[model samples]
Target: MRLVIAKCSVDYVGRLKAHLPLAVRLLLVKADGSVLVHSDGGSYKPLNWMSPPATLRIVSPDDVELEDGVISQWIVKSTKADEQLIINIYEELHESSHDLGVDPGLIKDGVEADLQRLLAEQIELLGVGFTLIRREYFTAIGPVDILARDSAGATVAIELKRRGDIDGVEQLTRYLELLNRDPLLAPVRGIFAAQQIKPQAKTLANDRGIECKTLDYDAMRGVDDSASRLF
Candidate 1:
C-alpha cells in the first residue's frame, strides 16, 4: 500500500458528483487498485474512495491546472463502472509504501460469530426462497457479513452487528455502494441484521432502503442442536 499525505482537492465524476476543497489530507493507493482520500478525522471511513477493480494513473497537470498550482493529478477509474476519482495534488507532504501480503482476514468472535454461522445455515430465516452465497464475502473496503440471493435472485449484501446502530447502517451503506458497482452485482441490496436494532439505526436503515432483521440468538442455536437419535 502506498500512503501519501499531500495538499489536494478532489472531484468525483460519474452518476453522482462531489467536490472536496484543497486541504492537507491522507491519500491511500492500495495494491488492489483502489484509492481512498481521508481527512485528519472522520474515524475510519474515507472522505472519498474508489474501490477496486479499478486503476490509478498519475499525469502532469495541464496548463490551466498548473497555473492554479496543481502539481499533479491522480485519476482513479473503476473498471466495472463509469465512476472516477480525480485528485489534484498541490503539494506533497510525505509519502511511503508498505508491502502488505495476503491478508488472513478479520476473525469474528463471540455471539456475533455464531450469528453469522447460524444465519448462513438457516438462510431461510431471511425469507422463503433466500439462499446464502457465502459468509464474509470479500469486498475492497471490507468483508460483507453475509452475501445472499433473495427469492427473486437479486444480490443481497448483509451487515451483521451484535447491536445494530447508526454506525452499522453507515457501514452497510458503504458495502452496498461498492458491491453494486460490480456488473455481476450491479443492483445489490442490503440488510442490517443484529440481535437488537436501535430505533435510530432502524430509521436510518429504512431511510436508506436497507431492510433490518432481528436475530434470535438462542432460537438459532437451538435449531443447530442435534435432534434425538435412535438407540
Candidate 2:
C-alpha cells in the first residue's frame, strides 16, 4: 500500500471525496484503559457527554496481532489519520548498511516490527522522535491505523484510507479528546490526515483548533520526509 502526507485540511477534504465506502472502523481509546469500537453500521451516538465503550478485548500487551485484511486496512488507515503515530521508534535508528557500521539485518528487524525504519532514521537525523501507542478502543471504533509524535513531543494522528468516509473528523476528534486528557502525554495536538474529509467537518476542525490534513498514498510510500527537515 502507498501513503501520502499532506499539510492542510483542504487537500484532505478533496481526497476523501474521491474515495468512498471505506470499509474501516473508528476506534476510541482512553488513557484509563478503556476501549471502544465503531465499525460499519455500528451505533456511535454519544450519551451524557460521552460514548459508551463497545466490545472489549482481553489480550496480552506483548502479544498484539491482527488478521491479514484488518492489518492491510489498518496500515492504509493509520498512514492517513496519524502518520507519526503508527511509525515505530526503531525506524529512526541510524546505521550504515554497506560498511557494516550498522547491521542491515537490524534494519530488516525494524521493518519486521512494522516500523518505518528509513523514515524513523531520517526523522531522527532531522531531530524528531516518534513512538507507537497501541490503543484497543481505536480498533473498535474502526482502526487508528497510525498515530505519531514529533520530537518536541506533540501528537500527530493519521487515518489511512483507500476510499473516503464522511466521519473522518468525527473519528479523529474522539482520539484527540482522549489524547488531550492524558496526564502522561506531552501537550497534545491533532491532525486528521485523510485521503479526504467532509466540507463542513473541516470548518468544525478549524472552529475547534484541530488541524485537517490530506494524504496521497499513491504518491508516496510513507510519511513525508519534509516534516523532519522543515526547520
Candidate 3:
C-alpha cells in the first residue's frame, strides 16, 4: 500500500461525474491496482475510489495547469469499466509505501460460529418439538450449518447468518434440493435462521417455501449449555 497526504483536487469521469475542490486529503494507492481518495471525516468510506483492475499513471501537469500552480496529476483508469478518477496534485505533504501480505478475512463481531454453536445447543428455539440432527451436516455442495428433525421426523436444513440476506436464503435452498434427493432425508425442509433478516430476504425465503426464524443471541447465550454438550 502507498499512502500520500497531499493538497490536491479530484475529478471523476464516468457514468457519473464528481469533483472535490483543493484540500489536504489522503490518497491511497493500493497493491490491488485500486486508488482511494479519503478525507479525515467520512468514517471508513472513502471520499472517492476506483475499484480494482484499474491502472494509475502520474503525468506532468499541462501548461495551463502549471501556470495555475498545479504540479502533477494522478490518472486512474478502470480496466473493467469506463470510469476514471483524476487527482490534480499541488504538493505532497507526506508519502510512504508498505507491503501488507495476506489477509485471513473478517469474522462478524457477534461471531457466526458462536451463533451456530448456540443454535445447535438450543435447537428447540426453532420450534416446539425440533431436535438437532447434527451441526455442520455435510452435503455435496457444502456443509449445511445445522441439520435437525421436527416432531414428525422430517429433515430440516438450517442456514444460520448474523444478518440474513438473499444469498443466505439461496444457500439454504440449494441444501434442501440436495438433501431431499436422498431417500433417508427425502422431503427435507429448510429454515433460514439469523439474528436479523432483511425484508427482501424474508420475502424471498417465503417465496421459496423456506421458513425464516429470527434468533435472540443474548437470550440464548444466557442459558448454560455446558451440561447439554457431550464434550
Which candidate leads the pack in lDDT?
A: 1
Kindly state the number of residue pairs that clash in model 3. 0
How far residue 44's Cα lies from its native spot in candidate 2, in Å, is 1.6
Quick one: best TM-score, which candidate?
1
In the predicted model 3, the residue pairs found to clash are none
RMSD of each: 3.7, 19.0, 12.9
- What TM-score does candidate 3 reach? 0.52
lDDT of 2 by residue, 1-231 (tens): 112221111101211221222223333344322323333463573210112222223222244663332221111122222211121111111212222243233222322223233323333322246554432224323444455666666666554333334466667666666554433453566655445667776787777677765544333455656556665
Instruction: Show where candidate 1 strays beyond 4 Å.
Output: 61-67, 223-231
Candidates sorted by TM-score, best first:
1, 3, 2
TM-score of each: 0.89, 0.39, 0.52
Q: Which lDDT values do the candidates have, in the order given?
A: 0.90, 0.39, 0.84
Worst 10 residues of 2 by lDDT: 6-15
Q: If both were scored by TM-score, which would come out higher, candidate 2 or candidate 3?
A: 3
Please give the range of 10 consecutive residues that has the lowest summed lDDT in model 3: 61-70
Two-way lDDT contest, 1 vs 3, winner: 1
2 or 3, greater by lDDT:
3
